[model samples]
Target: MDENSIAGAAREFGGKVQGAAGTVAGNDETRAEGKRDEVGGATETRVGQASDTVRDVAGEAGDLADRAIDTGRDVLPEAGAAPRRGGDTLTQYAKEFPLAFAAMAGALGYLLAVAIRRRR
Candidate 1:
């Protein structure tokens, strides 16, 4: 987006110079060039505005996610009521279904391997 804006600005600047030169020289071609530059400048302004809007929206989304996480943590009960170790979570899940967990782990490992290979 920034690249697009920069290109548009450059185009507008060039047009201005051409238009000014054309006006002084009394050339129709020069006047056309100047008008073209003005159009390019307007395009750059629009693109820059759009880029800013996207950034602001993305920032708001991140803030919302953080607030949701904090609210969820506040809702959960304290460990003093019943302390469940890290392994307890895995044990309970595995007891429910051991094969499913193994397959999930295998799939994750395969995905990681593929990603690493692609990077290389």
Candidate 2:
């Protein structure tokens, strides 16, 4: 995992230990601080996990784009061959990379909706 995840895990463990110690010593303030730390650490760890997920999705999208470009190049007309239709090309891509295609289509739809709303 990322640095935030590692640090958060460590902090969470420390907080648990501190909380237990505070409970044994009957210190309410220390116990509260430990609990707060535990919450903060858990939040940080979740943020780190989300960040990693975003990074992975972005990488996948990039790879998909690159592959699409390569496929387009390979499909280019040679020896007077007829050009492929846009719909067919898109259908091919959607079948080959369903998730990436869906993600891109959703993003495109969202952007279009936002643009249309802005015009109104």
Candidate 3:
């Protein structure tokens, strides 16, 4: 239990004791105060329980997000390996067609430069 829960329990026990003592002494005011304490203690205990429930829900959400990311990585490892395979294909094509590859590379560089300049 949290601090609020512990304090609430303590108050509840103390109230019971005070009420018993008040009853023995025939003190109406003391008995009334004891009853009020009992009600306050119950409210505090509910507050503590609510707080614990919220924390548990937030923790479960974080765990689910972590599991989703791990599953994505395991299911699509090829996404991470794609760049190496693409590079190998490009190298093979360039060896077979040097002049075509040079023209394509020059066009690609010009397009990249244009795009970068537009962004600024």
Model 3: per-residue lDDT, tens digit, 1-120? 567888887887788788878888899888888878888887887788888888888999999999988898899967877999999999999999999999999999999999999999
- Among these predictions, the greatest TM-score belongs to 2
Native-referenced Cα lDDT, model 2: 0.87
Q: Give all TM-scores, in the order shown.
A: 0.53, 0.63, 0.60
Candidate structures ordered by lDDT, highest first:
3, 2, 1
Q: Model 2: per-residue lDDT, tens digit, 5-60?
A: 98888888888888888999999989888888888888889989998999999999
Cα error, residue 46 of model 2, in Å, equals: 0.5
| Candidate 2 weakest lDDT stretch, 10 residues | 77-86
**Using TM-score as the measure, what is the rank order of every candidate, best first?**
2, 3, 1
lDDT (Cα, 0-100) at 35 in candidate 1: 85
Judge candidate 1 at residue 109 and give its lDDT.
Answer: 100
Clashes per candidate (backbone, < 3 Å): 0, 0, 0
